[model samples]
Target: MTSEPAEAEPANQPADLFDLSHNVNFLLRLAHARGDLLFNEAMGDLDLTPRQAALLHAVDRCEGGNISVLTVVTGMDRGTLSEMTPRLVKRGLLDRRPAPGDGRAKSLYLTPAGDALLQLARQRTASLRERVLASMPEEYHDLFVKMLAQLVGLETETRIVHDLPTVTRRRT
Candidate 1:
């Protein structure tokens, strides 16, 4: 007797893989823009940008992550970090202090007000994330997150590159 398997119907497969709306790049950009819009809307009351919120939250989590560490964590360039840090400090949302005995090395922390703001930002961010994921099956959220984490880096001969490293010179 023949043992060939029956062919699956076209209903189980996409008719075309090259559709622009279904393209990964297009989809990613569309989703990012939508998320950005919602995040800006939610954060407008506090006049906080996404980067500012990220920096504040990162500082809150790390008692004294230095500028270099924060640059790495927040994925912000030195120029932008320098500009934003002082503004946040001026606004009393962040504290910038010298690291222990190193007058040149500064550590960042969230002030009382920053902490409260971070809490509110966190709540809003979580709500936005939930809303975004609502279109997908709940069972796929973990897998979706995992797949996203995988797509971020480009592999090199010996390493994977995501973002530029934050470089800090050391005293001799």
Candidate 2:
């Protein structure tokens, strides 16, 4: 049988050229960093990190959310959450105690001070978000939020698969 013609190789180019993966990663990093900078500046007086505000918000909804739940909800590592919990506790923004039924675990609750700070942080974050979206059309805002949610959902699914050995190793 006649051999099939060999496929032509793509032309060699600089690493920066035609590197869509790098470009996408750079764009993500820049957008997140810039947004974080703007948010921090906007909420400077609130005396809370973005994650701290999120934790307070979560605790507000859950009443007595524990570290494990917060870890799942916030997508933060246990070490980071452990580190942050005590600081928030020291700031009078949160209270941590042994869980009612689980002696091995600690539960987190937002203090009155924490609630007040979270409200302020939420207001500032909303204002900043408004300013950022001011240039975009209203219709696009809904689409943007939808796309973000989709991305987050995909990320969560990937994390879950990676975390579960049976799921990760399953045959297609």
Candidate 3:
């Protein structure tokens, strides 16, 4: 008697093995893309990229901070901040001076123009935040931000701070 080979099915497999809609990475990417689109439409004439704005804001908050400090505060790399500083200085939006203790290290500061632009950007972005939050339920607003902060290891940080760095999504 010949016995038929028994078919074995994988145990506990999902109906759709690779469902992107339920993927964290894919969801984060889509959220980022949506944020960028909203920011671009909102910041009509700012011409400042999100990275550039973050750098400027960091300089303003940390006045006289060097590239290394900006990197820590902005979550940007040394190379990108180094490249951006010169361009901002050329545009008269930032000023670079020799660090007080370290002559070789240059400190950064936002010029009057940079500060003004940043203020405008902040206003526009406040509205953008409202729009983004509008999509989710009102009760989840704080929780949503908390969850994001936790994801980025900022859960321990105070929820409200006068100088907390803003995470913008717009770019030129």
Give each model a TM-score: 0.71, 0.73, 0.78
Name the candidate that leads on lDDT: 3
Q: What lDDT is obtained when candidate 3 is compared to the true structure? A: 0.75
Cα lDDT computed for each candidate against the true fold = 0.72, 0.71, 0.75
Q: Please give, for residues 69-162, the per-residue lDDT of candidate 2 as tens digits.
A: 6666566778888888899999999998788878988878878898889878877776788766677897798677668757665344235434
lDDT of 2: 0.71
Candidate 1: stretches off by over 4 Å = 1-18, 153-172
Candidate ranking under TM-score, highest first, comes to 3, 2, 1
Poorest lDDT segment (10 consecutive residues) of candidate 2: 163-172
> Is candidate 1 or 3 superior in TM-score?
3
User: What's the TM for model 1?
Assistant: 0.71
RMSD of 3: 6.7
Residue pairs with backbone overlap in model 3 = 49-171
lDDT of 2 at 69: 63
Better of 1 and 2 by lDDT: 1
